[model samples]
Target: MPNLLSRGLFNLFFGSKRKAFEKLPGPTPGVLGTLGDFIGPNPWDVCARYGREYGGVTLIWMGPSPGLVLNDPAVIEEILLTRRLEFEKGNIGTQIRPTVGDTVFIANQGEDWSAKIKVEPMAQPWAAAWLAALVGPLQAAINESVDALLKEPSIDLTPTLRRLTFDGFAVAAIGEKTPDSVFEDFMLLAKGADARLQAKLPLRFVSFPEGFEAAKERFYGYFTERVRRARAALNPSAVDLMSWTLREMPTVSDAWLGHILGTLFYGGVFSTSTTLVGAFHQLQKYPAAEERLAAEAATLAGAPLTFEWLRGAPWSEAVAYEVLRILPAVRIFLRTPAADTELAGVKLPAGSTLMVSNQHLHRDPSHWKDPETFEPSRWLNGGTARDPAGSGYFFPFGRGPRECVGAPFALLFLQTALATIAARVKVHVDSTEPFEEGFFFGVVLPKGVTGRLIARPSQAASLPGSVHPSAAVKTA
Candidate 1:
């Protein structure tokens, strides 16, 4: 990374002078202006504001880096898919490489990214099996937390869900139950690393990077232990994610696996939690969905959620997609121009950084019918995909060769968790703990800053064969 500016310095000093500008596809800018508000209301606000003025491909100068803000689906698609070779994952990838090693998010273009995304099965047959395996454990975990909530009557779903996600990932990925300290390890490491990078935090003073190193060691020890246990136990029927990870191990190194797991967990737990939290927030604003979902779940009294049920649950999927569309867990996805190229016809010089803001594109009116309205029905036709090939439109799991590798796993996990909880209890937001809306180490998360959330009971009932925990929930 130190070599980045060094190589570009020559271009900066004596390169061809081309006046750069953002050619926004739309009109009417928001409050987020380059000269007006450097620090906009939120990351989304910044992109929304800039996107309105500059259109499809805008420019965001965050500190020293010049970011090409790609907020349209067409342009984003072209960059990510049509002309993907011309782009690598930009700044965030390099910054996180030191910590995450190099997997998908941290991997530059070419063999590394291709290899990572390839091992995972495409979005089809495995989707059913994957979600089926996940639904069983995920439901139990949600039930464990929700049943405990009955003791107090309410709790913030954010942190509780984070723990559940960690447990699910640990069990699914390595076929092992993670220690409580591991959760602490992730929160500490992810938050610490995010704070350091975002605020330009220095590591030398307090050994921040070393602390991350220690966390990595602990996580790696666990990863190695679990994989060995899974491989040695080799009951083909007992296979889980360890089998999947191991299958791809030959092409990848232990260090790569460690960082991938770490980054995957950070990404999985944080993004799912954020989207769920956002879902609850959206639900609160409109309580009708809560009643409808509960009522529907109640009707399937004798029918436990089979893989078929998940497929048939179009309304649930619609709501989930709507929540993501309105409030995408990740706002900014950065891609570096590997070589000089014209994006949306703007001649972005080689080595230029592109900051694609899904946040603004999510709210774009041209592609969407009612941009601000949280109408899940819009997604009933599929997604907010005005153009399937366009990248600037909507990509919760991203797209192309460098898109999210674990998307199938994540979708399964999230769907099961949401279904189980929504079926059993209603999440009522009772606090004003603001969700920190910013990019954190290549993913998005609720601000890890301090605050408590409150939740209360509802009239939701259990489906067939679903286990209700006999113990009370404990709040720490």
Candidate 2:
């Protein structure tokens, strides 16, 4: 029968993946071997638990394929920093290719070489400048959410915060304001895209929810027009990311522009929103940490949120770092050896898939004192800041040249957004329902968690200034 033929083919393909790294220990096998480990409802948590039980280096399954996961920091560092040149993006790149296209984030080492060279340099400096410039609009977006929460008896804060991040990033990155309908459609498409990628199926073969493709096309058209407008404009002071890309990277194509914009939006909605929600949940669980953060935030009650202010707030930064440490938005990162290599004494042939579990590495007992505890004070010693691109023990955004380009902006946004909200309101977790785990795309998010916001007594009014609207140019 056709079913038997399919099963035989699946086993044949999966068997080779298992044979490549057969020396490693992993989850207990079922009738179909490692296939059961990944076909469950919450694969990320299941894999993280396996990493904990099977020592730092374990072989796991991504559907039928075997993936080698590294939780040891030295091995992680070697693969991510020192021996980075010997690896490529691997399955993660393949998973995200349909959604992100072939830009720097998902581009293989030698394939999209030219586009990588031209586009990679623009992300970092522009991230730094963009963070400093967009505080007003960012704050305005945050304030709207905060104000709306003030009016609600009890509301789903996840969607509200997610929307604010998307709107803020749309203005900051794409140079246009996304209407609610468009934003909704885009998010739906993004979720569908993420589902397809996570399923590791060919996108063309999968059926998406209604309107997913249309929403995707609309965003493409929108970005294409923005590029055209930027080209036609003569303004030297334009501040959005599109203007910077057009001005500095003149030869970049409209397709590349759209890819970059799509990556930014995807990150803004998915990673940043999840991190903030988790931070808020932690604050609710630990009032002392919240009070300490608010006290630190109170120091700049009415001061305009600037890069300097964000950098200077030690407690705010600490809380953010602690949240990231405990509940990293990006749980797993992938790589494969570009050449035959040995990792932690095991020989890995070229093209062997390797996964780094941020969740396991972060909570590894060797890295911290009582790693499970939610103690923000641990990060505040001697004014050390947690880099999203790991220093040694942490890697929320990962490390090396291939680390997230949006990291600088993401950190600043977290500090500013957290401080901006904490300064004015005290958030209490609505504990009627217990916290549950959220599996979205491939990352973990806060589920069943809600908060009640109360005005902090004697707090100063919101910093004065309306958010600057979309313009060809604005003061940076």
The C-alpha stretches of model 2 lying farther than 4 A from their native spots are: 1-23, 27-30, 39-41, 61-66, 111-114, 121-127, 174-176, 200-204, 250-255, 337-341, 349-351, 383-388, 432-434, 459-476
Q: Which candidate's TM-score is highest?
A: 2
lDDT of 2 by residue, 107-225 (tens): 76655743575556345455567567767666666766677666555555576677767876787776557777767766776777677766645656766778766777776667777
**Residue pairs clashing, model 2:** 86-338
C-alpha-based local distance difference test score of model 1: 0.60
Superposed on all Cα atoms, model 2 deviates from the true structure by an RMSD in Å of 7.4
Q: Worst lDDT window (10 residues) for model 1?
A: 26-35
Q: How many backbone clashes does candidate 2 have?
A: 1
Clash counts for all predictions: 17, 1
